[model samples]
Target: MGRRVIALKPLSKENVTSFYQWLNDPEVIRYSLSLFQKLNTEADIDFWYKGVLRDTKTLSLGIYVDEEFVGYAGISSLSSVNKSGEYYIFIGNKDFWSKGVGTEVTRQIIEIAFVEKELERLMLTVSVPNQGGVKAYKKAGFKEEGRLRNAALRDGEFHDKIIMSILKSEYKLS
Candidate 1:
């Protein structure tokens, strides 16, 4: 499969409902740990939809392949005490998994974080088992900064969270 990379468009009400439906599935929520775990309710999803449309520190993008919405990428947390934006993304459609859509979406998100947002840094945490996510983070110029001890509990076990970061000054992002 090939790759399709582009900017995130504003989410419309028409598309928002579909996004909510996609996120309700356990499979879609598995790796979206960086964001809140659940967005199943209409009020929660609608409120979130309003937030995503005009967030200053965080920019949201809709990901598409062959004109179909497959995922989303966000650079957010500008108001965080950490003084840097955090990256979050999800490719809700399992059919697009392992096909390189994530890497492309993330690269653009990182690029915008540095160049457009003028953020000092970008960071994200991934579940221990999300190897593909870790690899994509690395490919987008992030380094394995550290791991959060027993950060996430899934199924019957605790999973350490992998923390990755990229510095704006260190890269040609800006």
Candidate 2:
């Protein structure tokens, strides 16, 4: 089989419902930093939409496959002084998991961060237990930089967070 095609579009109101559903799905949010919190209402989603997602410093996008919304990806915490940003992605549509969606999305977002946003470096933190995520980030050229020991509490215990990053000089579009 050939690799699947994926696209990223600016996040918008049209994808709010899908975003809300994904945010609440435990399986989808398992590895997310906000796994402990709950977005219990449309208003909560709206608050995030207006506050963080719409913030001028962040670049959020809806992930689409065959024109269907499958997930979301973006670069946040952009720093003008340092030319750096934090990256994030999640395939909310569980059907797409382990199907190279994450890798493709990572590549696309890296491209945007480097070529479009002119960022010098991009970084992210992933739960240590999320092997698939670690693998995908590695495939996208991110190198493990360090670990945030017991930084996240999940399922009644603490989980280490692995810090990964890629500098603009290291990224090469394939």
Candidate 3:
């Protein structure tokens, strides 16, 4: 089979429903920071989308696979002076899990950050237990910087998080 078309596109109001459904899905947000947020309404998602649009330092995009919205990825807290930002991603569609989609998304984001944006550094935090995320980040050339002890609380228990980062100097453009 041929590889599915995957692209990061500007998010729109049309995606509010999908965002709401994914945010409300326990399985979807199990390993996501969305678990701590209270975006319980489509309006809330819409508001978030607007905020991202207005935020000059933030760039968020919907992850589309073959013309369907499957997930989202973004970079926030961008600092031009420091040339760094915090990277984030989530594949809300369960069917897409374990399909190498995350790795592809990560690589695309890296290219945008390093080449287009000319950012020198990008970092991310992943729950220690989210092996899939950790592996995907590593596969995209992010190296572990350190761990925050008992940082994330999932299912009433605290879990550690690993901080990983990649620098423009280290990223070899393909």
Candidate 4:
């Protein structure tokens, strides 16, 4: 198959079902902090969606690949005074994994957070077991700031969360 063009658009109700499914997927949630909690109902999903919409500090976007909603991306925990934010992205479509989609999504969100929003820094926390995610963030200019020892409990065991970040001064549009 030809490579599908990737794009980012504002999150809307239209993509909520896909978002809901992605959040519930074991493989997808395994790398995320959400793995600690169970999201079992559509009502729970709706509540989360509404929360995202109501949160003034977050800028959530849908990840599209040639007109198909494949994932989600966003900047949350924004602080105007500190000029900082938290970055997030996930490709719901398993077919797109390891295909540079995550990296592209990360790059796009960084542009929006730093250049468009003029945020000073963007940071994220990822499970240490998610090597692909860590590498992708590093490739997108995020540096390892520190580790939260035994911060996450998953699959009946405790795991570390690695904090990574990039500053506006360090970002270079490529």
The lDDT leader among the candidates is 3
Per-residue CA lDDT of model 2 for 26-91, tens digit only, reads 777777757316775778877776665558888888899888899778988999899999999878
RMSD of each: 2.8, 1.8, 1.5, 1.5
lDDT leaderboard ranking: 3, 4, 2, 1
For model 3 the TM-score comes to: 0.93
lDDT of each: 0.76, 0.85, 0.87, 0.85
Report RMSD for candidate 2: 1.8
Error of 4 at 141 (Å): 1.1
Across 1-174, the per-residue lDDT of candidate 3 in tens digits comes to 888999999987677677778887777888887432567677777787667667777888999999999988989998999999999998989998998889889999999999998999999999999998998899899999999999977778899999999999899887
TM-score of 2: 0.92
> Model 3: how far is 117 from its true place, Å?
0.6
lDDT of 1 by residue, 110-167 (tens): 7777787777788888887888888777877888889999888766578899888999
Q: How would the candidate models be sorted by TM-score, starting from the highest?
A: 4, 3, 2, 1
Q: What's each prediction's clash count?
A: 1, 0, 0, 0
Candidate 4 local lDDT, 22-41, one digit each (tens): 77777877776463167757
Where is model 3 more than 4 Å wrong at Cα? 34-37
> TM-score: which is higher, 1 or 3?
3
Candidate 4 colliding pairs = none
User: Which residues of candidate 2, in runs, are more than 4 Å off?
Assistant: 1-3
